[model samples]
Each structure stands twice: as structure tokens, then as C-alpha cells.
Target: MKKLWNIGIAAATVCLLSLLNACSLKEKNVAVLSLDKSFTTRSGFEGLLNGCYNDLYFLYGKEDFVAPTELGTDLWANVGTAGAGFTLYDHRLVTTDGNLKVIWGSAYSTINLCNTVLYYGKEVKGYTSQAELNAKLAEAYFLRAFSNFILVEEFGGVVLRTTSSTVEGVDNAPKRSSEKDFYDLIISDLKFAVQHLPVNQGLRGRVSKKAAYGLLAKVYLQRTRLGEAQEYARLALETAEELINHQTQYGATLYTSDNTRSGFGKLWAGENNKTNTEFLFIQAVEHANGYNPEFWNRGRTRQFFLPDLGGRGGEWGAREGSPLYGRSNSRRFKPSRYLLTQCFEPSATTADTRFAESFTYKFYANANKEITNALATTYKKDPSVVGYVIKGTSAKATASVNFYTQTIEEQTNMANDAGLAVFTPNWTISTTDKAKMPMMVSDPSDLFDPATNKYKDPAAFPDEVNLTNVHPALKKFSAPLYAQSNQYWMGDFSIIRLGDIYLVAAEAALLYNGDKSKAAGFINTIRKRAALVSREAEQVIAPTVVDIDFILKERARELAGEHMRWMDLKRTGKLTKAYLMQTNPISGELFDASRHTVRPIPQSFLDAISNADEFGTNGY
Candidate 1:
């Protein structure tokens, strides 16, 4: 439940060493107290695995230094400002420094744990079924591959240590492995995982054959083994199709609507794995940890989402257009106009529904408590808006009711702008001003329902409850009623989902196999569901001519801030070009050629390695 950030490798090592001391039986058994048999047994192994999940989970949190780096940077065009904050990050540019090391250290720590388990899980006596052990090893392999995938994507080449950290002369320091070699290891591990992991796991949230296949396909795609990539991608897609097409309710058990948002983006939200059909692997979370997310690192949310929904004054600036709007206190990350333009039009006329209801807008009601759709009163909408808004412990907004009123003719007379303005404001008063308008009356209770529930009152239904339109206070993460109680908020972050596979397969079918119509068919299927209107009303689907370039852009529109956009560009060799087009409104800047593409390797690594000069640093 508690988030596990990166492992303190040095501290863990010291503790383990002390625990192994023979004299730790009685007198001064401090080491034994720290490192008990729990670290050595099957249950202990499971605990370590859980601990590994905790550490890895941090990679998916809000903190850029530790969370899913690719999701924020490499996966998508930059969401926030550049230099220290936004534009600088838009291009493939990032300087690997202090906190970036957390990713490296955490990754290595997990590798060591998995290696230790693979080495020792077999030695433990009195174990469960052999199937369980194999499954555990398979899981270990899958995790190691997953972790390595992260490292390879970020740091390029890394020292691949399969065993526990060694202190002996020969193992005191290890040289970095070549990227090819590193990826080879990943491939081997994934292949093993694919072979050993069961197609179905009895327990929910467990990795299955489909998960392995999906990962294997991903690995192949990254390696640029086109044939292998296509083969595995098809295999994964086929398996996924079976699960999706099946009438059985097995999937709903895995992913339920209670906690997750209703879109492809939910996969990266990191919580609520009830929909087993899509989520292959995720680092689950139950309790909140301030230090583990962007909220603690700075004011940013887990990732950017539509303009802030929670009444402003929390992290990520006052909810963009809400009554709580303001200049953010710690402007670490910021959404830009260029990025906003990238998200499909939020209006009903747009073909992309994700741009509409899928996101919460920043505009909130003015004195009349009515919402204005004007950009001035709206938050900066962007691709990053698709990212999760991890509500922090210090959030100040409290749950309250919004009210609306209308006569029968008034309800039908939707064109009465002034009448609508009474319930929904025509303009949003910026949060910069703390003054509250008297006309902005709050509904007394948190009960405004359309159904036959006790909260249902047609007179004060959605209209008065602030439900009729997108407002700045409508942030993705529900604000905690009490800031302190936020520590207990349960939200999982996602890394992948079923929708991506559909998109990927659709793209692959057209690009690699020359099956344009089939690709368009698959993509159209997804688009239709999202409320996206077809370019031609008579033909409601993406064309089958299969424009790879167009589909790439479409993917950005559909999947943007979920952390896949940047990578898509990178693989297509458009990282630099795509980002250069993004302009920062605050500074009137474009992506700098030198600083936009590559991140500098951490200085600490340079300091640790004697021949570090051999490894060139990224231009940034």
C-alpha cells in the first residue's frame, strides 16, 4: 500500500551484511535484527518481490527524476515548460543529474533482488508446488526484463549485473555493457518469461502468457528486429483479441470502473487493475506517499491532465481556469500552448472524443457560477493533459456541491446564453484573486443526482452542482476532503493498456504488412468508441490508404500524454522535428537544437567510473 521508491542499495547491503554475522545470535545482534531469515525464505522472497514493486512503482509516480521518465519525456513531446521546466524538456533533451540517479539506483536494486531470488528461490527448502517456483522465476525474469527495459530506454548502455552486488576485488566495479548486449539479455529474459509464464494465472494481477508476449513484442520492436517485432506483435494482439472478444466476464473482475478513468489513458494511472484484459503489469498503490510523487518533488501532478479540476491553490498552479486559478507557487513543470494545440479539439465538433469529455477543462464559472469556454478563462490544454493528476497530501480543496436551476422552457432553450450563465458562469474569475463572488453560491450538500437516489433533486440537479460544463476545478485526481487524509488516497499508475496494442497492431498491419484497409478498420473501431466523428460523415473511419505519418499524429492525438508520443516520434526518427515545432508561449522559445534531444549522463556515474571518459555524454 505504501509506495516503494528506489532502494537504498548501500543501506540494504550494510543491513544484510550485518544480519549474516555469526555472533548476531544474542548479544549485539543489530545486523541480525535488520536482516532476518525473512530475507532468505520463500515468504521473504515474496516480500522482497513486493519491495521491488514498491521501488519500481516510484518510476511511474509524478516525480520526473524517478517516475516513468519515458512516459513524460521520451514517450511524449514535453508537457510543461522547457529551460528549467518546460520547453527544454520538450525535445529529447534532459540532463541526467541528481534525481535521475534514483532511476539508475532503483533499477539496479531491483535487478539485484531478482538475481538474488533466481539464485536463491530454488535453495529454500519445504517449498510449494514446482509450478509455483517456476512461476515465481518467470515473474522474476519478467520483472528484470521490465526494469532493464526502463534503464535501456533512458540511460542507453548500463552495467548489467545479474547477481547481487559484489564487494570482492574482481567485482568491485563492473564495466557498462553495450546496448546491444543489454538488449540481448532483455530479449532472453522475455523469451524465457514467455515460455514459462502461464497463459492464465489463478490470482488476479499476476503476469500471464499474454503479458509476456506483449512485453516480448515491445522488446523486439525496440531492438528493430522488424520481422520478430511483427511476429510477436501479432501474437500478442491475437491473444489480446481472444480475451477482448470473449463474452466471459473474466476481464471486468480485473479492471472495474470504481477506481479507474474511462479511457485508454487509464492504463498509466497505475491503480485499479480490475480490468485484466489490458493491464499486463503495474506497480500497484494503496496508501499515498508525498515523497513518491510529483506533488512532493514540486507542485506538478503525477502527470499533466486537462486543466486543473480541483479548485486551484494546490500543486500545478491554481486549477487553471477554476475560481482557484493562480500563478503556481513552485513552477517546476508547466503545460504549454503548443502542447495544448496537440490535444484534439475538446469541442463536440471535433472527431476525437478524448479531447472532449475524456479531459477536464480549466474554465470555471464567474460570479454567476457559470463556466466560460474561452481560452482566457481555460487552463492550458495539452497532450500532457492525458497524464494522471496525482492529488497530493497538501491539497486544499474540499468536496462541495454545485447547483443549477431551470424551468421546462429554460432547460430546452439551451440558446439562452444569459440564462445559462446564471448557473454556469460566462467567465472564470482567476484564482489569482482570492475574493469569492456572492453570486457563486454553493449547494449545501454533496448530493446532486439525476437518478432516483436520495441525492436526486431535479431542481438542483447537475446544473447547480457544477456538472453541466468543464470548469477549472474539475481536475482528474479527486481532491482529498482533508489534506492529511490524502496520505491514504489509493490511485495506481499505468504503463500500458489494451488500446495501445490495438493501435500498434493497426499501425503494424498497415506499415509492415501493407494491409491498409485492415489497419484503418482496427483504428476506426477504437475511434468510433471514443466519440470521434469521421472526417467524412458518410465514411466514419480513418482511411485505409494507411498514411504512417498521419497515423503517427493520430496516435499522438489519441494517446498523447500517456507517455508514448515521444517514443513514437523517436522510433520514427522525428523526435527532433516534432519537438522543434512546439513553441513555449511564456518565453517565446523553440526547442534548442543542442539541448532538446539528449540528456546528459549523471555526473555521479562519471565520478564513480575511472574510465568514464570513454562514455560520451549526451549534448544536453
Candidate 2:
């Protein structure tokens, strides 16, 4: 047992947990009631089930909860550093850390709700069909499995709570279960989900049979090390192939051609987030209201890994209107040097459509917007001396423009599409071209120093402007409309999608056997979809040889900030060391395999438990 969270259950506990916001039947996204119903009617049963799903919003969209998953990963670091700092394993990452407490408490709360559903669901009688009743129960099973899956992966070898927390005190089950026990329960629940869950849950964002299959595939791949590693890999491959082979049956298709007006940018272009068929499962939010609008307003997936664009005076529009620049969020998880250099520079010879789609390569201007020197300096505006921020100055760009891309090439005739700011970290844009361009330019030399893990000397820009102001921004979850006052970018968060499934299938085959060709084929399915149409052939892997390293790299390129990098590294034994090591540098620098794998048991939970000494902190 790495850690134990005494899921002390009581009526008061259930009531207190229920007080949190959840999906409403009135909304278009995930819908259900607050579960005031006693599960006597069909609506009551569904409401209770939906409440179980609500916890996901607490984890996924919430900032503190996301810190553990994204901040300490290989692909991303703090917005200013070359590698991760505190979240990796600094002293600040303690047992009393609020983020850890929130995670442990939230997961157990969701599990308790599922347990409550299983206990009282039989009383729910208004079923139109047997499948409906089965589906309802299956959803409960899946939700429980999902929460426990998070528990095991995060804290390791947790107790499997089946029955509702009916007692008035702590759950009597004290001993922590084995990792195998946790997976057995997870697999059993998911198998039931596969058997009963419909292809379409009918409501948008509801988990389906296909969603269960995708999740099952990922679980098996992670479960390889416990025992029967090869067999688990085979099961993973088999399950993932089911989705890959017959995606149409499950109402899914990968966005292959990123070519229309914005090229690969169409995939995450905000307008198409709801209609993106490639999403197997997502935390889809409505355009207007998501969950309880006011309370859930903090639920955000925007501006993280995004550079401080707001600081650059209103080059990009303010976030109140549509087609505007995304709002200034507390941007965390800056891209690591590895991600910028090794990962997405057209990894193959082909023009990788993903680089343009994965990031925001261009920024537009906000014409006629007033600027103040004081506001400019307060905003930490880069190039504050420019006309855009300082006002009446001649340095501001006037139109939407890009640095290296052909969208807005050259300094001449840059009328409707002008460049206010350009970020060309990899490109060696010549001084002549840069001078001719109308915007402030930030190349690799001007931004944060990867080797030093520090921002470059700011003497080049205005006293208020620092080079850290310029870097690549992740636009995958960007939604400008979702960024108004009281609105965090509440767009649909793609949890397990078709792109990730292809990689799962690829990795599973290679792990099951040395089948590089089969793995390459699976990977190419995604690569081709991510490539420029004519150059698709060039994006294909040679298939001569493939290994875990290649698979890991592909996963990083495809699924970098999708809330599972830590698990990917952990499951593969790649998480080791506590400081910079030659083998694992960016993410795993502070990852101590012994203690860092499983987080510390929340002290609040420990304080409540009677067997405190017997069940000590999980080696924190």
C-alpha cells in the first residue's frame, strides 16, 4: 500500500458532497439533477448517476486538481522555466498539499455517490425498457470504475468500496487492497459496461460502450506490469482495434484534413469542438451554460500552457466577443524545450498538420483599442514601448499576421492581415525580414533560455517588457467566447478521443510482441490524419523498427496536455530520479520512484482515522 485514504462515509458526508454543483437536466452538456430525488423514478436514478460524473469537472477543469497531472509532466513546465519546478517534487509538494487533498476527497466522494446509486438504484422503477435499466446501472458501474481508476493510478493500491457508505462513521475496511485488486475491480466494472453500455448514451458527453472500450484499452495497457503483461497488452490491442476498425458504428471519425480556411487549425477551432467526431469521450460544455453556470465558472481549460498574450497590449482582442483573443488566464505549464525542439518540428519529413493545430502560431490585432503606459506596464506588456501598449507610438502592428507561415507573409501589403506579435522559436528569421515585418518579433534567443532554465536578458526590450512574454501558446482548449468575465474557458475537454486510441493500439502491439510493423501501421493511421493531404505518405513510419521510445514520443506529440502524461511515464517505469539526470531531464528530473509515484495520504483523512499509527502515511 503506497497510501491509504480512509473514505469515512456517513449521511452527513453524502449530504455535504451533494451540496457541490452537478449537471442539470436544463443544460445541453452533461445533464442530471442534484440528486434530491430518492431514486424512485427514472429521472431520480439518472440524476444520481449524473452526479457521479460531475466529479470529473472538479478534477479536469479545475486548476489545482490539474496541476498534478500537467505541471509535472515531460512535455510542459512552468510558464517561465525550461523544466518543471515545484509540482515535479519540490518541498512544497507535501502531504498537506491542498491539491492532493482535493483530489483524494473528490474521488472518494464520487465513489460514494456511485456506491449510493448501486445501493438505492434497484428502487428506481420507471424503466421504459430493460436496456434502459441496465444502461443506468452500467453507468453507475462505469463511473465507479472510472473514479477508482483515478484513485489507483494516483495514490496506488486503494481499497475497493463496493457498497454504499451506509454507516455513520468511517468505512470499516481499513487494509489497503493490492494494485491487482484495484485493476480486477476496474476491469470487471468496465466489462459490465462493455456488455451493457449503448453505443450512444443519447445525451452529448455521456460515456458509451465505445468510450468504455477505449478506456478499457488504456487500462489494460497500464496494467501490463502487475502480471500477464503480454496478455494485457494483447487485450489492449484487441479493444483499441475494435474502435479503430469500426468507428462509424460508434459515431466517430478522426478530423483527417486540416485544410479548409485554417489548415489543421480546424480540429480545435472552437466552432467545431461540439461536432468533432474524433472525440470518443469529452467533457463537453454548452456554449451558454455549463453545469451550474455561476459556481462552475471557475472550471477552465484555457490559457494553460499559453504565453502571456494579454501582457502584449491588446494585439489579440479581449475575450468578451467571438473570434476574439483568448482571455488572460493564470497560464501554467509552459512548453518544455524538448516539446518545442524534438517533438513537433515535423517529426517526419512531411508537413505535420498537428504543429499548426496543436499551437497558436498566429496572433491578430485589436485596432482602435486605447492603450496606457501604466496599464501596459502593469500587464507586463512585452514591447511596452510599442504603439499598441504605450499609445500614439508608431510600433504597433495593425492586422492579423504570422511570423514564418504564409498566412501573412512579408512586410508589404499587410493591410487587413497585419502582424502585431510573432513567435518564431525554431525558425531563423533573418533581420531583414524581421525588420520589414510590422510586429514585435521573439525568436529562440529572445525568449526563455532552455539551457539555463531562465528568461533571457530583458535589456533588449522596454524596462517593462521581458522575453518571457514570448513563447508558444496551446490553443487546443482555447475558446474565446468561454473567456468572458465569470467564464473560464469551459469548452469540451477531450478525455479519451480517437487520436489517443490509435496510439494505444500501436503501443499495445509493440508491447505484446516486437511487432513494429503492426505498431507503425496503427500510429500511421493517426499521423496520416495529422499530415497535410499530399504529404501524408511522407508522414508514415518506415515500419522497419519501432520501440517504446518511439511510441512514447508519438504519444507526447498526439496527447501532450490531455491530463495523462504522469501516468504514461509511471506505467512505463520511466519516472525516476529527483533532479536533472541525463536519461530523463524535463519532467522526471524530480521524480523519485519510491515515494513520488503515489502521493501522500491527505492529513485530514488520516486525522479522522482511529488506526492512524497502524496505517501510516504511504511513505510520503
Candidate 3:
């Protein structure tokens, strides 16, 4: 089958406009491709709907929406100097920040596209039947609701624009709607979607009826979190169970562990990545077809998880550009020590495979492979680096360099391994013993202050702490093996998956009624999938107890880089300094719950609208 995202190119030929009638709206300040032109043909209408999802690539593939959702939260923190402004929540995170502007603009643009599609959908021709037309309309509904949900979550109660921002229904100086207004449209949209969306769209990145049910469950739960209504928890649980119980019918199920690869590992890496049955909603990109590099616009989101593994002289810089360690740009975000220490619990007897699957602990010697493809751009070779000739992709590493989270005993024995370079362990090691070792071993004491959960300042140490140099290489996104480049890489970004739905079910069950037993059943399913070989039973909970906090931690463990951390903390009323100090303490102290919970509305947006005074800077 032809890939879904080639809609724009394909539209030019198959869905040519019979008549061009573009309308301008003062509100959006962008011309809407008139529905009359779009609905002239079924292919044209399909192109219009797919255009609604095209904005998703701009939002998801870039740092705009990802930073708003992931940074300043507990699971992830800024590395080096790039995101300190937003991560620390200081003067840099103000309304004028480019990222803030991008978030607000991209969302509204997507919403406008959906509104246009829905407004003139009935006029669409060449549909085989009412069922086909309803399914198409249902997709637009999901996109509109999805975009609005992001708006409401990021910026509280926004101007509700149900009508297309075209000449047909122009409302130039619209005032902001209440949260109730947003949820009403959102609920209505999803209910319509659930009634009409097909069980299987048979295309990656498209939403299904199961996706509608899943998202509705979350929407209701969010309403409860916003203090809108408490009775909605029942609805949330019921909707979540509707999707959960009918997984087999919907052709979705959890990936189970095989002898060779764990389910969690298989879910992200290997042959089944883009086609994984678990993925419900995604921003999928087909290889080569998705090679448009509008100044670094490729899906380099995987680069966010890596350290700046730049070239150094010794084993520390052994593999500066290996596909195994994966390529990284200077702007990267590493996992918090709080996330590494508190959330993951891997024991020798009952190993947690999620810890291993999510992070990369070892660095292979870079073989300086030639980048033949022009699109696969990489950093230029550094003069001072010590990389070897190309070896088999997975050949043995001559040296070991890592930021490993290990037991003190494991560290002590591993410290004896030959050619161990730049060893930084989480557990404490003695200062005297460190000097005697052949390798440049780190004093685990210098890793972080156990009291504060903050990393030690580089200036405070005798040897400057290589904070950005040899940290763990995050591989959950599983950087592509063949064509390596930080400039552009085609990787699929998952927005919703079955693993998250399982967590939602557990959360709703506990929140709706204190059904700890019911919550345990849902959570244990995810834990079992993450458990190591022969230890699935050890990962099980006894159904003795569960709570909102436990659900948040499990989410952190399971879906860290999938981008929903800041919202998770805020939704559960745990965005307080107390919670941050205990968990993500670096910026936890810098956070001000008074204003930090809600991001400031972009200055560009405020300046653009006639009702600027009404939509102030969100108390910025």
C-alpha cells in the first residue's frame, strides 16, 4: 500500500483542485484551502484530513511540544546548557521564548485544518457509503480534539474556535472559553469518533475507534484532575475498560517476552518497530519518502535522549560517531538520577529489563565508517579523537566506558574488567581505591549528593565532572542502524500505545473507586512484560495496595521519553516543590508552583489577537 504521508505530493496529481477558492481569516492570519475545493473529490477530502496530521510532524518531530511536555518535569532534565531556561523555569521560559510561540501557533494551525475539514465534510463526494464518510469525519474529530487537548493542558482554557477560521464562519475577536467549554467539545468529538471510527484504519499514524476510546478515558481523567467534576472518574474507568477488555477484538495486545528479546525491547527496536501491534496513535515516517530537510526538520527526536558523545582522546572518546552508541546533537536531555534511582528497581534475582532496554550503558569503539549518503549528515571528524577502523557492527568493545547504575558489589567486580574507561557508578566507591585502579574510575560520591538528588557541580570537583561526556546512551527510540546522522533520521514517534492504556486503566480503577486489587491487575500486566527471563512472577504485585503516586512512577518507568511527564505531575497535583525536591530536585527547588504549573501564553499570540488584554500572559 502507498504510505499515508505522501498525501501532499500525491494530492497534486490524483486530487487536483477543480477550482481554487482560498479564504483568509484575520484570526488565524492564514488562508484556509476552502472546503469547496477540498470536497470536490474524495481524494481531495482525504488530502485535507491528512494535512491535519501533517502539522503533527512539525509539532512532534521537533522540540516544540516535546519540551513543553517533557522538560521541567521529574523524569527528564536539561543536559549541558541548551534547555536550562525552560528546564529551570526562569526568565528564559517567558512568553517571548521561540518554543512557546511554536507550541501555541502549531496547535491552533492544526485545529483550524480540522475545523475546515469538519465544516464542509458532508459536501464530500465519491464516498462508497455513509460508513466510509463517517469514518473520515471521525478522523478529523479525533485530530481536533487531540489538538485542543494539548492546548488546554499547556495553556488553560483557550479561545474555543469550533468554526473554521475562514470567511464562512469568522469570529475575529473571540474571548477565551471556560475549561468546561473545551471539555464539552472534546467529549462530543470523541463520542462521535467512537461511534464512527473504524476498528482498523490499516495505516500507521492514523487513529482508530480504539484510539478514540483510549483518548476519551484520558480526557475524562484530566477533567477530574482539573477539578471540573469528580463523577467523571467512573466514566474514565468504564471507557478505559471498554478498550482494555476488547483488545483482542481490536487486534491489539501486549508484546510478550521471548527467549532472545524482551517484549519491552522488541516493542521499540528490531523488525516490528513501525508495525508494532501495540502502537495505537503515532507520528510515523516512511524512510526516504520522509527525507525533506527543511533546515534540520527530520525526526531527530531520538537525539534528545543521548549525551554529547563528542570526540575525546582515550576510551572516553572511543566511538564519537558509532551507530551502536547512536549519533547525538549537542542539545540533548539525560535521565535524572532521581528517575534512574527511584523509579527502576532491578535486582539480580528479579531483574527489571526496562532499565536495560531504555538505557545504553556501554560505548563501542567508533570505526569511523564513511557517510556515503548526503542526507545522513554527521559531525565532522575531530582531530584529537581515538577511533579504530570499522569492525563488524556488534563486534566486542576493547574498552568499557559508562555511567552505570549498579550494586556496589557489581561495580567493584566490573571495576576489575580490562580497559574500563571513565567509569562512573551510581553506588558509592572509596576515594583511595579509585586512585589505585588502572582505569579512570569515578568516585560515585561525586556522581550526585544523595541528600539533594542533584548532580555535583563540575567546579566543585578536583577533576572537572564530565557531565555531558560519558553518560548513558538512551536507546528506547532505538536509533536507526544503517544511515547514521544527527542532521536527519527517519524514526517513528509513538503518541499512544497499548502500554500507556494499561497504565491509564490502572490509574482510573484506583481513582474511580479505591480498587487496589483491580489496579494491581492492570499494572502487573505491564510489569510482567518488562520483567526479565524467568522472573515474570517476581515482577507481580500482591494486589495488597496501589495509589496515584505508584501509577506516576510506573508511567515514568514505562513511558519516559514518550513525552507526558510534566502533565502527569500536574494532573495528580504533585507539581509541588515537596515532590520535586524528593524526586527531580535539580529544578525542583527552582520551580514555583504558583505560576509554573501553567505555561505563559506566547507574546506573539497575545500581540496578534485583537483581544490581547483579555488573553493576558497567563500571569507571566
1 or 3: which has the higher lDDT?
Answer: 3
Q: Write the per-residue lDDT of candidate 1 for residues 206-285, one digit (tens) a residue.
A: 56666676666556555543245556445544544544454133232122222223233342232323333456554444
Q: Please, what is the TM-score per model?
A: 0.65, 0.81, 0.84
Q: Which candidate achieves the best TM-score against the true structure?
A: 3
Kindly give the number of clashing pairs for every candidate: 56, 5, 0
Candidate 2's C-alpha runs over 4 A off are 1-37, 80-86, 128-130, 167-169, 258-264, 290-299, 310-323, 346-350, 368-417, 422-436, 448-465, 480-487, 578-580, 583-589
Global CA lDDT computed for model 2:
0.63
**Ranking 1 against 2 by TM-score, winner:** 2
Q: Is candidate 2 or candidate 3 better by lDDT?
A: 3
Alpha carbon lDDT of each predicted model: 0.44, 0.63, 0.66
Models, CA RMSD each = 12.4, 8.2, 7.9
Query: Candidate 1 at residue 479, lDDT?
Result: 25
Give the alpha carbon lDDT tens digit for every residue of 1-620 in model 3. Answer: 13345564332221111101112242232223443575558887888777677667777767676678888878777876667766888777888877777777667766777777786686878988988899999998998899889888888887777766542544435588887889989999999999999998766678898789888988888888766344787888888888889888886777898666678887876356667788778776665344332423555566666655554313332434443444455446777776766786533233567877887654432332322222111222232222322221233322221112111111222332432333444334465554443333433354565665767665665464444344554566654431234344455667888898888888877777788898999999899888755778878876675788788989988988777888788779888888887778767777897788888988776665566787688878
The whole-model C-alpha lDDT of candidate 1 against the native structure comes to: 0.44
- Judged by TM-score relative to the true structure, which candidate is superior, 1 or 3? 3
